[model samples]
Target: MIDGLKRPACALPVLLVGLAAVGTAWADGIPWADRLHAFGKASKLVCFLPLFVHFQNSSRTRLVFAAYLLSNLLLLLLSFVVFCSPDISILIGAKSPGVPLKNYLDQTQGFAFIAVICVALAIEAIRHQQRGQAIAFAAIAVAFFANLAFVNIARTAFIYLPVMLALVTIRSVRGWPSLAVLVAVCVLVVGAWGVSPNLQFKMARLLGEVDAYETNTMVIGGLETGGAERLEFWRKSVGAIRSAPIVGHGTGSTKELFANEAAGQTGIRAKIVDNPHNQTLAVAIQWGAIGCIVLYAMWGAHLLLFTEGLSRRKGSLLAWIGLLAVAQNIVSSLLNSHLFDFYQGWLYVIAVAIVGGQLQRRRDTDQS
Candidate 1:
């Protein structure tokens, strides 16, 4: 029994290192990018097996895992049914409504699967009486997957799996040398980010475009800003919020409000801006200050809990990974629309639970 436990424990770090190395290679632009991408996609099935085995050993962890899995399965079935249904156009009163429910169905399927896996892993760590480990798992999973889902599913999964492996490596070894290597890799990654022209250009363009629109709001200039249509919608949204400061006009009111606000303005008309590009601003407009405050409080509570867990296990590699994951998710939330999506929200909740569970475990251990 001792030998069996020791072997898997010893093997874990080596496997993680191998995973990290593969990830770093991809980041640096490995040869045969297409083949690498395909291989990575194929590997997910294999990767999930070990994860399943790890969680299945514990009853509580397994139950949580089953719940998450069942939810995803249900979501998948719902999506599949929606996709197969014929597109129907229904007339409600005077307006003709063309609803593409299929689009929504197709989009959320991957997110559901990803969320289930991450939540399960986090819960597993909690059951094992590894509070820091659980938090670290959830944080890393949320941060990494959030970004990946923001960009591309396959690419994100490819990069994330390796980083996770590296983290697991640091957990098993509990050595300074292993940690030093991880630190060195991180520095290299940051340095690469500084030098990559494509990354720099995209970041600058996104920030600059948003800034220019905000600046133009002060001017008494002509109504047309050519390609800055999104800005115009944003301006209209601000006016709507100002008009109803205490409570929002209503949920899904932005489009209507934008139309009414821009009614008299030349060249600026209400377009289908389903969501504001910025989530915080969107929530503020839809739900008013009260809604924003409630959302912020929830966010703050989760962060506080995760931070407290970190303090208890300052040396945990998993904790560091979790910190990075949380940071990634916060940043991604600013640019993406996943916070309100059911699967995504549940994933975030699980992440918080995972970290919280880890903290509870540590407290119990300390008391004993």
Candidate 2:
């Protein structure tokens, strides 16, 4: 019974991590959320020290560790190139001062730090031969919630790594029941305060206005202007794509095209929108359908890696978390441009490493 009780403790950290991701608006005034985020950041930094010590003692899967490092380095390099190159603007023919290379590098370095911590925890789990299935599932759950449209999708991937670890440590069904109760209580509390009601009303009103504007043949006076503006922009974007069905006008050219097209439309004079509200359309405009296909393939590869773990039931926890994270990213991608976020990129690498480590462990066990 004590052991069963202990299982829920593992779930606590994960639950906290998920809440931290989903409830950031609430955290504006809440001391616990602020402290949790601060603590999570600090813990990620210190996590590597004990992990390195454990690895030295256990002498397990050093090659996998090396591969993880290499993947992180590649991500860091990609972030650097994207943010640093002044010439990149020239290549893409886009306008706007490029992001400072140093800042970009520093941002990704933080992710690298978090990745180290996650890898360390994954190694610890392997050493103890703990249940990996639960951890993976918990990670997925956190990722799914974190990737909600309003949340910072880029941060969802890395922020939930610790949650996955916590899930693996849980040993009881009681933990699930407790989590359900907590979620219910949070929903009721938020609902009573008008948060849920206000959010729902606002989202519904916005969508309704957009739909009404689309369907109306006659112009309605004093109709909210923003919805009409977005529709106009979306239409212009579709026209641009039709004109250049093969290669796009060029990378970064969509904004200028959008602005030009919108300028011609009556009652809409907004400056060129920087991004299409839709991520798929934005990518299609920049990279063309081929680029979009390649992007999808890359995401599919990550999903494949996580699914492979599930098939073997070797690292079920890591696999579930990874699948959730990847799924959230894929879904969120419909609305947000997460491909460029430093945090999510590193999280992807760490997740893959966790899966790889599990596969390696299984292979080793089979050999023995």
Per-residue alpha-carbon lDDT of model 2 for 1-368, expressed as tens digits?
22211322222223323332343332233345343433343123122223322332343554655575566445444434543565874575533222223332233333423342453355456557765943653353333232222211122233343343334333212457757744664574356335433335435555665655566322344444444555665677788778766545544455567666656544454446655655566656544565466456656655675676666655664466556556544654444444333354445444444444455456557668
Model 1 alpha-carbon miss at residue 324, Å: 4.1
Estimate the Cα RMSD of every predicted model relative to the unseen true structure. Answer: 18.6, 18.1
- Residue 3 C-alpha lDDT in model 2: 28
User: How many pairs of residues in model 2 come into backbone collision?
Assistant: 8
Candidates in order have lDDT scores of 0.45, 0.45
Per-residue lDDT tens digits of candidate 1, residues 1-368?
Answer: 22322333223322322332343332222234432442332232223223323332333644665675565446444433333443422321211111123332223334434443464467657768899978875774564334323322322233444444464445444578778767875775566457654335434454554555655432223323322455665666677678766555545555555555655554335344545544566656655675466555545644554555556653242344344344434544554434544444444434434434444445556878
lDDT of 2 at 211: 59
For candidate 1, what is the TM-score? 0.44
Each prediction's TM-score against the native?
0.44, 0.45
Which residue runs does candidate 2 get wrong by more than 4 Å? Answer: 1-198, 201-205, 208-233, 264-271, 341-368
